[model samples]
Target: MFALNRKNSTFNFKKADFPKLYDLLSKVDWSEMTNVKEVNAACDFFYNTLECIFEACVPKTSISKISRRSYPVWFDSTIINCLKHKARVLKKFRMYQCQRHLDEFKKLRSQAKFLIAKGYSEYVKSMEDTISHDPRKFWTFIQTKRGKSRIPGTIFVNGEAISDPCIIVNNFADYFKSVYTVSLDNNYSANMTTNNNILLPKISEDDILRQLREL
Candidate 1:
């Protein structure tokens, strides 16, 4: 694999960079670039100059690997604070054996639960209106709310257990293919309509026609 040759150049926009950026942009002469090539060069120059000015004005930090914890979408600062308060209450209750601390913890816990449930309900309700117009988006929203699926790490294939991702994927693909595929035999296909006594649900054609006409 070819390693990236590009340097990691990252800068955060600060209030101090505003005047420098404005000054850099104000010096541009757009009228001089008459041809496409000149225009392209001018555009590149403007972008590069802007970047230089931004780099000079703002402090750049070296990219470092950082560990982050992923939380649910409904988890905001309010929920975090609520959880922290509950934890503190629990700790105090345990330390002092105080009934009030326990009661406070229970109250906070109930409030947090209600808030989480309400958040999820609102989240789901928000998608209801989109179901008719954008079903794909609606289902995507539902799946996101449901979070990740917990498929078993190991699956049986041809009487043997397999856990490798590629093998499991291929096994599932093969199973689905076999289940959905229709096998055809020339003799049976040629005499397809010969079976006169096939069980099918009886329905009134006139009723169907009436419904269609109404539609």
Candidate 2:
């Protein structure tokens, strides 16, 4: 099992007073920035002022999330509550070595296991039933089971195996450049010049109104 930790930040825009922010911005003395002689100083003042205004209007919040790879996808409220109950039973059994507590723990453990298996089987059956109509979903489930894909350590270029990352990237860039490069010839250039020389017909307001009426 692996755990991945990430931090996400978002602004509370729903609670923000955008009208007040606009009024505040409109009242700001932007001429204060003009007093700064250096371009960097002026930019710093401008950014700082706006940052203070935004901080007051729309506060930001940071949340930390931890994801576990061992967590099952078929987990639901019923399964979760059963598992929690089983854990509590096991804890009571451990604290008090009573035969009744031990038996209860064992029973709950078996029930939890059964519920997990049943949930997993039902999820698989649903996927199987929808496979013909939604193959993409089936394939996505397959991919999740297979886990993340890794880039190849070596690549073939011009019938030669290359292991250097820089060389492989350069080869890809060169190949794409060749594929997308446009070739210019005398004939193409002459055609472009002739097309540029062709004049478009002029249309008056009356003609535009007539076309709109027809539409």
| Best-matching candidate per TM-score | 1
Give the per-residue lDDT digits (tens) of candidate 2, residues 42-87. 9877877876777779867676554442456777779877877888
Q: State the weakest 10-residue window (summed lDDT) of model 2.
A: 1-10
For candidate 1, the per-residue lDDT at 146 reads 66
lDDT, residue 104, candidate 1? 100
The CA lDDT of each predicted structure is 0.70, 0.76
In candidate 1, which residue pairs get closer than 3 Å at backbone N, Cα or C atoms, i.e. clash? none
lDDT of 1 at 67: 29
Candidate 2 TM-score versus the reference: 0.43
In terms of lDDT, the best-performing candidate is 2
Runs in model 2 deviating more than 4 A are 1-11, 21-70, 148-215
Give the poorly placed runs of model 1, Cα more than 4 Å off: 1-70, 131-152, 181-215
